[model samples]
Target: MKKSMTMMLLLLVAMFCNAQMQDPVKFTAQLKTGNTAEGEIVFSGKIQKGWHVYSTNLGSDGPIEASFHVDKKDGVELVGKLTPRGKEISEMDPMFGMKLRYFEHSVQFVQKVKFTKPTYSIKCYLEFGACNEEMCMPPTQVELNKQGKSPAVDGEAAKEEEAKEEAVAITDTAAVAVTDSAAAAAPAALDTAEVKKLWTPVIDELNDYDQPVSNSLFYIFLAGIVGGLVALFTPCVWPIIPMTVSFFLKRNKSRKKAIREAIIYGVSIVVIYVALGLVVSMLFGASALNALSTNAVFNIAFCLMLVVFAASFFGAFEITLPSSWSNKMDQKSEETSGLLSIFLMAFTLSLVSFSCTGPIIGFLLVAVASEGSIVAPTIGMLGFAIALAVPFALFAMFPTLLKSAPKSGGWMNVLKVTLGFVELAFALKFLSVADLAYGWHILDRETFLALWIALFTLLGLYLLGLFNFPHDDEGRRTNVPQFFLALASLAFAFYMIPGLWGAPLKAVSAFAPPMNTQDFNLYKNEVHPRFTDYEAGMAAARLEGKPVMVDFTGFGCVNCRKMEAAVWTDAKVADLLNQKYVLISLFVDDKTPLPEQIEVTDTDGSKRTLRTVGDKWSYLQRYKFGSNTQPMYILIDNEGKPLTGSRSYDEDISEYMDFLNAGLDAYANR
Candidate 1:
C-alpha cells in the first residue's frame, strides 16, 4: 500500500507539476567520404532511457514521424533520401490511438549527397518525436552539418568502426503529437542555447496572440449547476426532499435553529464539492485534464464506465459503495454537535446518492475536461453541489412545500430507465471516438446510425408502454411527459433514417459519424474548399482581395466534421463563407505525399521536413498560427495576418456568425 501510494504521488507530481523543456536525445554528426566528393552525412542520436523517436511514414494521426531536412538544398545535389538504420519497434500505441513505428535506444540517420566540387559545404538536419509512457516532448531537431570543405577520402573504415559501436533505435520529439488533446502541447526543448546558430526564434512576426476571449469556465459552472438540479429529480434524491423537511421540522420544532442548520447543510455541500475540486487540482492540472479527454485510454475507460452506469440505470445491477462507509459518516453526523456534524451529514447524502449522481458527475467531468481547464473539475462540482443544496435550504425554510411534492415511485423508475437509454446513446459516442482514432472502422457512419436508430426506436416503444425493464412498472400506460418524449424519440429515429443514405443530418451531425464515413452520401448541397494548400489559398485570397478563413482540420477529426455539417451548412454561414471569404481547408491528418519534400526552418532555427501534404499544413498551424488542434478556424487578411482571433469547434451558429462578422469588420477597418 505504501508503494502504491508513493507511485501514485509520483505520477501526480510528474503529471501536475509545470515541466521544463528537456531534450531526451543528443545527436552527433559526422561526414564520411566515399572518395571526398560523394559520400554520406551520418547523424547518430543517443536516446535517453524511456524515450523513443518515431520512424518515417507513420500516419499523420500518430506521432510526428522521423524525417530529415536538407537546409542547403541548392548547395549540394542529393544522391538519395535520408535513411534510418536501427532496430525499429512498431506497435499500437493508445496515447495517440494509432499504430506507431519508432526507434528506441540509439538510431542512426544517413543522408547521402553528391558534391559539385572536390571541396564543398552543406547543411542538413533530422527531426523526430520523442515520447515515453507519461508525456511527449515537442518535435526536436539536431543539426547534421557545418559548412566546410569535404573531409579527405579515408571514411569507410572510420564509418564502419563507429557504426559497430553506435547502433540503436533513435530519433527525437515532434511538438508532443499534433494533438496540441484533450492532448497537451509537448514541452519545448530546453537546449535552446545549443541550437541557437541554426535556429531563428519565430515570435517577432506573430502579432500578439489575440485569441477571442472564452467564457467557457462560466459555462462549465452553469453545466454543473444544471447537473445538480437534474440529480435532485433522480430516484435516489427526489424522495428525500420531504423527508428533509420532516427532520428539520422535528428539530425541537424550532424554526430558527432548523433554518440555521439547513443553511449550514447547504454550506457543507459546497465545502464538499470545493474540497473535491481541490483534490482534482492537486492531481490534474490543465494539461492532464486535456489528456483525460484526448488520450485513447482515458476515452475508452470513460466509454466503458458510462456503459456500466447505463446498465445500472437499466436495472441490470445496482451501483453502490460500501454500506459501512455511509453508515460511519451518518454515525459521525449524529455524534458531532456543530458544523462538522452538518458536513458529515452532507457527506452521507453524497455517498447515499452516488448511484444517480455518479453518472451525471461523469458526464459533467468529461465535458469540462475536454475543455482542458485545470479548474474545471472543481468549478463544475461546486456548481453541481450548489444546485443540489438549493432545494434542501428551501425545504428547511418552509417544510410544507415538499409535502405536496410528488413521491418517488414508478415515475422515478421511468425517469431512471429513460436516462439509461440516453446514457446508452452517449456510450456509443465515446466508443465511436476510440474507433475513429484507432481506425478500427467498426462503427462507420451507417453502423453508428443504425445502432442509434434502433436504440431510440426501442426507447420510444418503451416509453409508449410497449415494453419494460426489470425495475419499471409492468403495465403503466404512457403518461403525458412519456408520450411527448416518445414522439420526440420516434421522430428523431426517423430523422436519422435519412442520414443512412447521406442526408447530412445536420441536427445530429455533431454526434453522428462524419459523412465521409458513410459509404453512400447522397446529400448534394455542400461547401467545397477552394484550396487545400495554405500558401496557395493565401495567395489567391490576396489576388481576390478577400479575407481568408483558414480551416485547420483533419480527416479523423470528428469535431471538424461536426462544424462542417452543422455550423458551416447554415445558409447564412455558407453564403458568407462562399462569397465573403476565401476558405482554406488544411487537413492536418492528410497522408497524401507532397510532390517533393519541403524543408522549413522553425522559429527556433530547428529544421522541419514537410514530406506529406498533411505535414505541411500541420507545420503551418503549429509554427505560423501557434495552434495544433483541428476544427480550428481563423480569419486572416491577404497578408497572412489574422483579421481577428481564431474560432474552434463551438457549434453555436449565432456565435460563429458573430465571429465571422467580427472578422469582416476587422478586415474592413484595416
Candidate 2:
C-alpha cells in the first residue's frame, strides 16, 4: 500500500510540473545586415495561433504595449521610432475605452541603429504580453543579444545559459501527444459567423449614433452646400461669376459651344476638389485618420490651425495663395483656347478666391477627418464641389439670372466676421480633446464653458452692431436677419449658463468634459456608494451579508458613463443598489499603480504579473467571467459565485431594474 501511494504521488507531481510550464510565444531577433557600422535590428515573434499581441503606440489607458529597451552601450546609438510591420487589427476595446491595434500569427518590430566601434556588443531586452480569447499572459521580458548571436563567456553568463538550456531541454522532453479523448475535450475555435459577430460595430461604439456614417455624410454635404451658397455672397467669388460667364458669352461665337465649355469648367472644378479628397484618403489610411482624431498632438495642431484660420477670417490678415501661382494660371487661361482655356480660368478662380474659400474647405476637412471614416472626406468634398459647380452651371444656362442676384455689400463682411466667431468656438473643442487625453488641467469643463459663453456673447453683440472692427461699415443699425441671428446667439449663450453648475448639459456632452471634472456642484451624478478595490468590496459584502455588484468601468468609456447617467439613476435601480448590494466600480483604464507587486499563475499555467490597478481588475474580469467589456455588471455572493447573469450597457430602466431584482432573488434563494 505504501509503494502504490508513493507512485501515485510521483505521478501527481509530474502533472503539476507539466501544467506549470507553457510558452505560447517564441521571440527571435537578428541584425538586418552583417556590417556593424550602421544597421537595423529586427525583432520578430511567432505568436500561437489563438493569441495576439498589442502594438507599441496604444492609448494611455490600454493594455501593456509591446516595447524594446537597449542597455546603454559605448558606441551604439539608437535612431528613429520603432516601426511595426504587419496588418494591424483594430477594435474598440471597452477596457481601454478606445480603439486598440494588435497583431496575430506573426509580428515584427524594427529599430535602426548606428555603431561607431568596429566590434561592440549591445545588451537588449523586449517586453510584451500575449492574450488568447480566454486569458492573457502578463507582460514578459526576454533578454536578447544585440548582434543576435550567442552570448560571450563569463561566469554569470555561463551559469544563466546552462539554466536556460536545462529549461529548454525540459520543455522539449516533456512534450506529450494528445489522445483523441483529450483533443475532443478542448474548446473549438470560433466559427466564421461568430467571428463576424465579434467584429460588428455596436451602436454604443459609435461616437455619433444619430449621425452615423450615412447621416454624417449627408449632413456634411448639406453644410458644404450651405457654405457654397455663403461663398457666393463673398467678395471674391461673387464678382467673378458675372465676369467669367460674360467672358464666355462674348468670346465664343457659337452659343452652344459656350454652354458646353461652361459645363466643362464646372466639371473640372468638381474633379479638382474630389481629387483632393482622394489624395487625402490615399495618403492617410482610415486607421491613421481615425487615430489622428483622438491623438493629443494632432488635436493641438488642428486647434492651432483653426485659430489661424479664424484670425484670418476676422480680417487680421488675408490667407491668399501665392499671387504668382494665380497669375500664372490666369496667363495660361488667356494663352490657351477652347476647353483648355475654360478649365484654366476655373483653376485660376479657385486660387484667387482662396482667402474666402480656404477657411471653409479647411473647416470641412477637419470636421470630416474627426468622423474617422475613410469615405467621409471624399463624400464631403464631392458635396462641396457639387454645390460650388451648380451655381456656375445654372448661371451659364440662364445668363439673365445674374441680373437679379443680390449685390455683395457689408453683409458679406458680416458673414465673414460671424464665421470667425464660430471657428474660434469650435477651436476650443479640439484643444479640450488634447487637454482631456493628456490630463492637462489647463482647460476644464467650467473653463471651456466660460470661454464658449464669452465668445458667443461677443458674437451676439457684434451682430447687434454694438462693436465694429477695422473692416466693418460705420452703420450701427442691425438688419432683420442680423437681429434674429444675434437673438439666437444670445439664447445659445444663455442656454449654456446652467451648465456652469452641475447640470448635465446632454446637448453638448460629447464636446464638453465629463461631469466628474466639475469642481463645484449643486447636483452630484453618482448613484450609489462605491469602492474601487475588488477585495475590499467583497469583504464589505461578506460583513454585511449581502451580494456584491462588480462594475467594470473606465474613465474614457462613453457608454459606461451614459449608462450611469441614464439607467443607474432610475429611482428603483438606485434604491436597490444603495440599500442591498455592495458596489465595486473597478475602472479598467485606471492608471494607478499597485502599492505592492502581485503576480499569479493563471489556470492555463501562464504567469501573469499585475503592475497596475487596472491590470488587476482587467485580469479579474477576463479570467473569472470570460469577458473583457464594460460597463459589465456582475452580481455575486460573498464567495464570488455569480448570483445572476451579467448585465452590459442598456438604457432601458425596466430591463435594468429587472436585472437587479433577479440578482437579489437569486442571492436570497441561495
Candidate 3:
C-alpha cells in the first residue's frame, strides 16, 4: 500500500509539472493624433476570466507604474499623461507596503506625443504589472508601435490645429530624445549587438517548433534501416544461416517446402518485432515522450544503463538467460507451433547473442528516446530485430554463400573491441548529463576533450596490436576493416586536440562546447561580444528592470536538439521573445573555467575548483533547483524570484506560448 501510494504521488507530481493549465491574456493598443501632429499612444490590457491588471496612478505604492518609454526618432515627440481607467483605492500588497489601485479585468492608459511633421511613428516600451486574486507575477514589458496622422481640415480649422501641434511638439521633443539616447547607449557597456547576433540560432530553434510530425516519423524509418544493417554484421544472426538452411533441408522432403518455411521465418520475425513495438506504444502513453527526453532523472538513469551495457561490450560479463529457458523454447518449436516457433527461435537468437547485441540495443534505446516520441524506442527495436532476423531467413533460401563467410577466430574479437570503444565513447554523453545536473566541473571542455583523447589513444594502441586484452587474438594480421577503424579512432582523437585551446570545432559544433563558453578560446576571441555570462546578462535584465530568463543547456544533450528544432520555432513564441524577453542561455556542458578565487563548498563538503563554465552554471542549477537537465527555462524577477513554475520541454509546441506568457504574467505582477 505504501509503495502504491508513493507511485501515485509521483504520478500526480509529474502531471502537475507537465500540466498545460494556463490560459493566455489579451492586451490591445490604439494610435491617435494630438494637435501636435505626433500620435497620442493609448495602451489597454484586456484580462480574461479570473484575471486582473494593475493601475499606474498609485502614489508610488502600486505595482511598478504602468510605464512607457518612446524610442528616439528625430522630429517625433511624445508628451503623454498615462492614467488608469479604473477606480483608485489603496490595497496592501505583501512585497510592497504602498497602497495600490488595480483593475480586476482590464486597464487602459493614454499618453500624448508631438511630431514636427504631419505624420510620424514611435515605438513605445510599455512596462506594467498584472495579477489574479491570489498571486502576482513579476513586472513585464511590452513593445508597441503607435503611428499618427494629422487631421485634414481645409480652411479655418487647419491653422488653429497647426498652431496647437507646434506648441505641443516643442515641449515633448526634448524629453523623448533624451530617453531614447540613454536606452540605446546602455547596451554598449556589455556588448548587446554581439550577444543578440550570437543568439541567432534561437531563431532556427523556433523554426523547429512548426516542423511537421512526418519528418520525425521519416527519421524513425531511417533509424530502422540503420539498425537492420548493423544486425546483419553481428555474430548471432550471421552464423544462424547455415544452421537454418541445413535444418530446413533435413526437415523438408522437397526444395519448394524448404523455401516456403524460410519465407515464414522472415515474415514471423517482422510481425513479432512490429507487434512488440505497438505494445510498448500502448503501455506508455505518448505524453511520457516529453519527460523521457527532458527529465533529469530519466536522463541520468539512461546514462547509467548505457554504462552497464558498455561494460558488457568490453567483455566484463555476458548477458544471458538460463539454459532451460532456451530448452523450453526449443521444445515448443518441435511441437509445430508454427508462427510461435519462429518467434521462439528469434527469442533464442537474442539470448544466444546477448553479449554482442546488448550494447547495440541499449544504444538504440537512448538514441530513439532522445527523438522525443513514445513510439521511438519501439520502432527502433522493431527495426533492429527485423534486421537481425532477415539474414537467417535469406541465407536459408540460398545455401551457397555460407562458404564465403569470414572464418571466426580473432576477427570477431576485433569487432567486439571496436564496438567497445564506441560504447565507451557514447557512455561519456550520460556522464556529461550527470555533470551538468550535479554541477561537476570535472567534465568541462578541456577535461572532456582530454578523456576522449586518452580513450581513443588506448583504442588505437589496442587496434595496432600493441596492447593485448584477455580476449584478443594472439595472431598478428591487420585486416583492412581493422586498419580503417583504427585510423578513424586516431583521427577523431586528433580532431579534439585543438578544442582544448578553445577552437570552434564547427564540424561537430552541436556536440562540442559552444565557442562562447570556452575560457581561452582561439577562433572568435572578441571580449564581451555577446551575452556570454550570467552576471552581464542579469545586468541587462536590470537595465530593462524586467524579469530574467535562465536557459540551462548543454553540448551533449540530445533532447535539447529536439526542443530547439520543434518548440522554440513557433511564430507566436518568436514574436513574444523578440518583443518581451531578455534571454540568457547558459550551457551546462561548457568547459570554460571560473576565476580561481571564487569557490563554493558543496553539500558533500569537497573542495573543488569552478574550472568550467558548465561547472558553475550546473552547480547553480542544482543548488537553485533540484534537477539539472538541458533545455531548462527558468523565468525569474531581476531579484531572482521564480516565475512560471520553471519549464522543461520535449515535444509539445503549443505549450511554449503558455510558458512564456506565464512568466510574463508573473513578472508583470511582481
Best by TM-score: 1
Off by over 4 Å in 3: 1-215, 513-519, 525-670
State residue 215's C-alpha deviation in candidate 3, in Å: 4.2
Superposition error at 568 for model 2 (Å): 7.9
- Tens digit of per-residue lDDT, candidate 3, span 533-625: 665676778788767677776543334544553345444555566567777777665545544423444444433233446655654555454
**Which candidate should be chosen as best, given lDDT against the real structure?**
1
| Candidate 3 lDDT for residue 202 | 30
Better of 1 and 2 by TM-score: 1
lDDT of 2 by residue, 409-455 (tens): 78888888888888887788889878866676678788899998899
lDDT at position 455, candidate 2: 90
By TM-score, how accurate is candidate 3?
Answer: 0.51
C-alpha positional error of residue 31 in candidate 3 after TM-score superposition, expressed in Å: 30
User: Which of candidates 2 and 3 is the stronger one according to TM-score?
Assistant: 2
**Model 2 global lDDT (CA atoms, 0 to 1):** 0.67
The positional error of residue 502 in candidate 1, measured at the CA in angstroms, is: 1.7
